[model samples]
Target chain A: MSEEIKEILEGLPFWEHLEKEERELLERESRKVFYPAGASVYSGARECLGEIFIQKGILRTYLLSDEGKEVSMYRLRQGDACVLTASCILPAITFDVEIEAQTDVEALLIPVGTLSKITKKNVYAENFVYKEAAKRFSDVVEALQQIMFLSLTQRVAAFLLDESAKNHSQLISVTHEELARQIGSAREAVSRILKQMAKKGYITLTRGEVKLENKEEMYKLLN
Target chain B: MSEEIKEILEGLPFWEHLEKEERELLERESRKVFYPAGASVYSGARECLGEIFIQKGILRTYLLSDEGKEVSMYRLRQGDACVLTASCILPAITFDVEIEAQTDVEALLIPVGTLSKITKKNVYAENFVYKEAAKRFSDVVEALQQIMFLSLTQRVAAFLLDESAKNHSQLISVTHEELARQIGSAREAVSRILKQMAKKGYITLTRGEVKLENKEEMYKLLN
Candidate 1:
């Protein structure tokens, strides 16, 4: 880890508590890899393999059923932890889904066994992992609640707003198909809704990018 | 707790490793209370409360949105722990949902403050709590995946199978309105599907009870 990326990792809730030495131990065990679009970083069961920190680019978590239906469970952005959310845990964690790079991606993959070794020897590491698990668990539950209760339009608006915040850019690169999978809707329906929102002046769409024209106006539709 | 219920609790992951005396402490703190059908045990925005162990009857967990729309999150049956699932360790947990008794009910409540104290002092207790949290987290995530990916009819069938297994009965006492909220659909739509399923001999429906006549056939539909 470079001084810059190490500083960022140190800011992360999970790694923040580790002593400089312990953090180095983690860094030593971790393998930094870059994957191009459509590559699988980890392809296996749903078992808790540990955690991965997204250093760059975008990843999508999806499940493919035996019949080949694709279900997009979540998308991973930079600074996100893969294992903390859903990767591999005991009691047989098989990913009915696969993790795919949406674009060129860089990530730090940590094995669960390595994490367990460190945590077992260090109280700080143990507490950090537990806390990280708790936080990620809450996020997954919140996402579940949102999907259950929020309307499709509300979901799209929220997703757009979140993406805008994350990138700090009004313009985000996404296709209708990807958006539909993220919000668990049909591609055609998402396209229609996006078109309608664009016509209403809340957003503008172009090839490979959508820009929010009026943030306040779009938020009002969240209700 | 009686010897019988104590045995049951001991079998649960949370109580499995506790010393007999330590287990007795939990038993002493627990008090059984009963509620009539249609009673609200806890409401939204309530503080992080104690855990509840269902001794008898069915309970529903649901959120009442700002627009007064009710979204059912999960159903709690006998032998389930409610407080463990509702803990607010960090990020300041808020009760987004209410717990309501769907039938005459009896449950044991364990205060969160006491559990916190126990966890701080007892390693076993802390481990038990963390493990329970992890398991519950997995359960909630699994449910979200189902909701996001599964077809409406598939979800309904799977829900019926789950309820049947929990209650150990073919007949489940759930109104169309309750089923609709659980599955995030309209009550009329749920009714239409149930009626159709009944006509096809998949289930038998009375005023408020539904019984699966053929579990195998229903499971096939869920796929």
Candidate 2:
């Protein structure tokens, strides 16, 4: 198991930066973790979950409001390393969010003790953390800008277009509830907007799926 | 000038992490900059403005949309160290923001080359970057939440109350335009809301100031 962890660690970008001894030490200490699809991966505040390096599948990170609105922050895909999940290690990260596996997953969790020692002693390891946090910082700002500047319909339109591009199909297999959860809107509100879009010939809504109709009109809504 | 720079550098939290030679090198390389109230501090994309440490006054970091809507991200107060400003060094911070001096400001700008060297060689210096980025990441999340869940009225009420507390008085001496800008609302929208608040006797809006008329009522609006 430890040898497998070492091989996985070597495949990561930070692998080249790790000193030989520290690399071996981290491989020995790090543990592999798995979460079934739709399972809660991390939640609550300041519970050092350790840094997670996603090897397979995706993790959706979102914030829950007092009224239970779920605002998706961003997703961590394969090969992504997350520092925000291990907020306990970094004292300044005071807030917490929910992370769930979007699919059956495989990942390595670098335990807190091992990572702490490396960050304390290894500038390269610490530099990796800074780089990851900096990357996510800009992403959060983009999310903030979207929420502040775009209308709900605009956001819905943009999300649909983005999904269509990624899936290489106009048909999006998402229910109203899932769409609401992903975009931080009420399900009823999402339904109402979808109906309006359907009436406008921008999309065709079927049970559990939405298909883009007039792609240009839907794209126009994004602006 | 370099001697003065050394004295100021000694007062910062990251000063002790520097080696003796790095300290002298940084002090000589660093420059002091000042901005008058409400001047744009940083703008554009992928430009390394260098790392800035605030010595006096405040900076408001904000995003501008295509239609010219300005959304305030967060503020950088005295003693704050910023990494997002120097996005060129950290490739992950791709989003650009307009930073404005909220007041008369004095700050230290560590040139990108010098900072790059220290962060490259010193774990502690790199640790400071990670910590600062994490702090701001949580703050950006909070700002996003406020925009997501809070209504325009609730946001206005909360902003007025926060400003009152900060100024240590019930009267917040800011114009409607300034209030709108601070909380990322339209000036006319802020006026309408303030009018509604005034009608409810929750607050009194005068020529260029807002006085908390009924503090309890104003606080209730936050919820």
Candidate 3:
């Protein structure tokens, strides 16, 4: 069990920098959690969830407004940890976002107290958390810029192009409603924009997928 | 000179957490910079500025669209540090926002290399950076929520109330153009909204300012 825990820790990018004692403490204290796809992993305020380190699959972190509008913040991929959970150092800071499993996820859950203790004593762990937080901050800023500055059509085109590239395929397996939620727009608006894109020969939309036809046009729209 | 540096360092909230050697290095290496009101402090891409610790006054960090529209991200006041400048930990992560002196500002600048070195070696320093980054991340997320989920009128009303409260005056000393820039809206649109509010006896708009008349109605609009 100890060796297995060590192996799991070693798989993380920053684990090699951890001290032996720190690794041992983490192995002994942290709990492993598994969530199937579409499962609501964590929600409510930041205090509810402890420090989460994704070992496999993906988590979608988002915010839902009082009026039921949802804005997708960012995705937590494998080896990504929730830096916001380490809020002990940040006073009354609150993370009012929800985390859901986008795919079957295997994650390590460390209690906030344990993580805070380690962060206080271990430079390597603190650096890892700091870097993760910084990266997430940049991501949030980029998402905000897209939502505020870009037109709905431009956003949809850019999303299609980026998703296609990310999946290494011209066909993106996503729905217009999903796209709307991702870009923080209405479903009808997203569907209308996508239909227009199809009319322009930029993309071909089916029931739940969109196939890219003119990558150049889509890139132009993105610009 | 060394005593003066120590005194300056001690003025910071995180100063006592730093080790003696870290404090000495910061005293020897960090440079103090001052910017008058409305001065462009940091702009362009992420490469220009290093880690910044604001000692006095206010710095407004904002994002500008291709069409020249601006959205205020957050403000860094006294004892606040720029977490974006700690991007040395995450390679290729860029912060594209522009920083301007909202008021006459005094700040401490540390080279990227020095910050990176100390962050890697000192847990206390890393904790300071992590907390700052986490706080900024929360701020960005909140800003994104406002941009994506709230109505423009609601945002404007909320902004007025918040600003009034912050200044301890019902009279907000700002132009409609400045308000539009802060909320990422057109100047004409903001002016129209303010006019409508004034017609409804919610506010009284002057040449370059607005005075709140009905706080209850403004709060109602915020809801």
Residue pairs clashing in model 3 are none
Worst 10 residues of 3 chain A by lDDT: A84-93
Distance from true position, residue B171, model 1, in Å? 2.4
Q: List the candidate 2 regions with Cα displacement exceeding 4 Å.
A: A2-4, A12-21, A167-170, A192-204, A212-223, B2-4, B12-21, B45-47, B117-123, B199-202, B213-217
TM-score of chain A of each: 0.77, 0.88, 0.86
| CA displacement after TM-score superposition, residue B13 of candidate 2 (Å) | 4.4
DockQ of each: 0.33, 0.67, 0.59
lDDT of 1 by residue, A99-133 (tens): 78888998776677777776666555554555455
Native RMSD of candidate 1 (Å): 4.1
Error (Å) of candidate 3 at residue B85 is: 4.9
For model 2, the local distance difference test gives: 0.82
Q: Tens digits of per-residue lDDT for model 3 on A1-223?
A: 4464566667665577778887777878888889999898876654455678788887887888888788988888876787655555545356667778887998888777777777677666766666676677777887888887888888898788878876689998788888888878889998999899899998898989899999998888877
Best by lDDT: 2
**In candidate 3, residue B177 scores what lDDT?**
90
- Higher TM-score: candidate 1 or 3? 3
Misplaced by over 4 Å in model 3 are A2-5, A11-21, A85-93, A111-113, B1-5, B13-22, B29-31, B85-93, B111-117
Candidates' chain B TM-scores in the order shown = 0.79, 0.89, 0.85
Q: What's the ranking of the predictions by lDDT, best on top? A: 2, 3, 1
